[model samples]
Target: MTLHRLILREIRHRKVNFALSVLGAAVAVAAVLSTVGALRAYDRETEAVIDEMEEATKAEMAKLEDEIRKSMKGLGFNLFIFPEGQDLSEVYAEGFASRTMPEEYVTKLAESGVVTVNHLLPSLTKKLEWPEQKRTVILIGVRGEVPIAHRSPKAPLIDPVEPGHLVMGYELHRSLGLKKGDTVTFMEREFTIDDTYEARGSKDDITLWMNLGECQEMLDMKGEINAIQALECNCATVDRLGEIRAELGEILPNTQIIETQSTALARAEARNQAAATSRAQIEAKEEQRARLRAEREKLAGWLLPVATLVSMIWIGLLAFINVRERLPEIGILRAIGVKGRTILGAFLGRAVLAGVVGGVIGVVVAKVVKLPSVDSGPIIESGEWIAAIVTAPLLAALAAWLPSLAAAQRDPAEVLRHD
Candidate 1:
């Protein structure tokens, strides 16, 4: 019989041996497929988790930004820019600046591309006697905000006072028994009360607001302003006031800038806290992903190799047993002038056949089986399928190599005598 026929006969005669050998190969292939699938699953899961984290972080950041914006509006202007020669002690004690700067100074600062400040408001403020009401009050003149060329237009923090109208303080209007739409005369100019403010327990309670040009004309300080109120930008650094001062110095050399420490600090802290919270959340997710990947790698690192080695050893052991059982057949064939090469081919062929069958079985099991670790289905690639099919036969051949070689080299005389 030919070597092919011989191999078939041997497999048929030893069905148990062939089945066991095929089982070993199938086990190895399945182990490899499971390990690779699990790792791929982990990678996919990590990507999905990172995507979710980014979206969540963005939503949280937006919410924090909205909250900070409302808080800033409540805090109001934090920086006061006035003439360099003015004394801050007097300004604080009297609740208004005594010195005056050119109104154009505010325009220069706004258009200077200075990014450290926002909401530039030029106002001419003074404590004067209301001749018509026979009482003293602080008068503040305001106009529309100057647009910054480099920044988008925002809603004005303090609305502009319209001409011929007045926004009176709570105490001023209450004590004078004035209400909205009532005519009030100040500095010989007639102005109608447009609105009255609620109690604020501050000098604002005794203050009167009017149009900038009208106030300047009445005070005979046309084109001049005593103060420029602004809100400082919430930058990452703590030296924001210093930076604003430096920028303003270059633009308005005769002006001095002062910061409201409580408001400025609170704004900066709120922004910083929001940023830190977002960063921490993303970092936590990244660290968790890294940890999971390392664990999966460590598990697969030993698992695949251990499984392969055990299958190889099992196939080799079974081949050795098959050789022992076929010694008499080998002896009879050798005596009839069958070459050792034919004997070797027969043994190796049987192993290769078993390998091919086992590989097919392994592929099917891998496709059907679902691992607990992987949430998604089995991730089998074309390359993995090829490796499973190709590696199995090679492993089987290698396992049977030494046993087949020993059988081929056995002496017919000794084999027949032992049989």
Candidate 2:
């Protein structure tokens, strides 16, 4: 009979051993594919989770930034820029600058492309006696906020005082018995009451606002401004004042910058807290993903090898039993002049057949079954399928190697005598 026929007859004669060997191979292949598929599925899940987290982080950052912007707007201008050599103590006591600088200095800063400060308002302020009201009040002059060349324009925190009009403080208007549209004479100039402010417990309550050109002309200090009020940006650096000074020094070399720490510090702290919260959330998510990945890896690290080892040992044991049971047949065949190589081929062929059939069934089952750990579904690559299929037969061949060798090298004379 042919080697193929011999292998077929041997499988038919001992169907139980052949079926057990095939089952072992099937379980091994299925286990390996399941493990690999689970890992791939987990990797895909992680990537999707990270992508979603990134989008959420961006949205959260945008919302926080909007909140900060609104908070800073409410805080108002926190930086005051005055001409160099002007005493801050005098400014504090008198509520206005004693010295003056060119009005064009503010325009120069606006055009300088400085990003650290914004909302540039140039004003000429003085403490003068109101002749008509017979009250001593501070006079302030403002035109409007200057727009930066490189940045988007923002709404002015303080509105501009129109020409020939006056925005009176609460104390000046209330004490003087004046209301909107009422005429007031100051420094011999007639100004209609354009707006009246509510009571503010500050120097602003005792102040009078007028047009810049009109105030400069009235004070006989034309084309001059004493102070430039601006809002400083809350950035990542702690040395904000120093940075602003350096930038201003480069643009307006003869100007001095003063910060209102109460407002600036509040804005900075709010921004810092928001940033910290964002970082903490992202870090926590990353740590969680890493922990899950480590757990999966730990489980896979031992499970695959143990399954493969058990399958190999089971196949090896089954081959040994088959060899012992077929010894008489092998001895008779040897007496009939069958070669050792034919016997070895017959045993090895049965193992290869079992491996091929089991590998096909395992691959199909792995594709259909879903792992409990995987949420989406089974994930298997073409390369993994090829590896499993190709490795199954090789594994079976290796497991049967020792048993097949012993069968091929058996002493026919001793085997027959023992039978």
Cα TM-score per model: 0.66, 0.65
170: Cα error in model 2, Å: 18
- Candidate 1 residue runs with Cα over 4 Å from true position: 8-20, 51-70, 82-87, 90-108, 112-115, 121-146, 150-227, 237-240, 249-256, 262-278, 320-331, 360-370, 377-388, 409-419
Global lDDT of each model? 0.84, 0.83
Q: For model 1, how does the per-residue alpha-carbon lDDT over 27-82 read when each residue is reduced to its tens digit?
A: 98888897787678778877888888788878877777666755564454567888
Best candidate, TM-score:
1
| Per-candidate alpha-carbon RMSD to the true structure | 6.8, 7.5
The count of residue-pair clashes in candidate 1 stands at: 0
lDDT of 1: 0.84
Query: Candidate 2 residues 274-315, lDDT tens each?
Result: 768777777788788779878888987898999899998999
Assess the local accuracy of residue 275 in candidate 1 as a C-alpha lDDT between 0 and 100: 71
lDDT of 1 at 103: 96
User: What's the CA error at residue 133 for candidate 1, in Å?
Assistant: 19
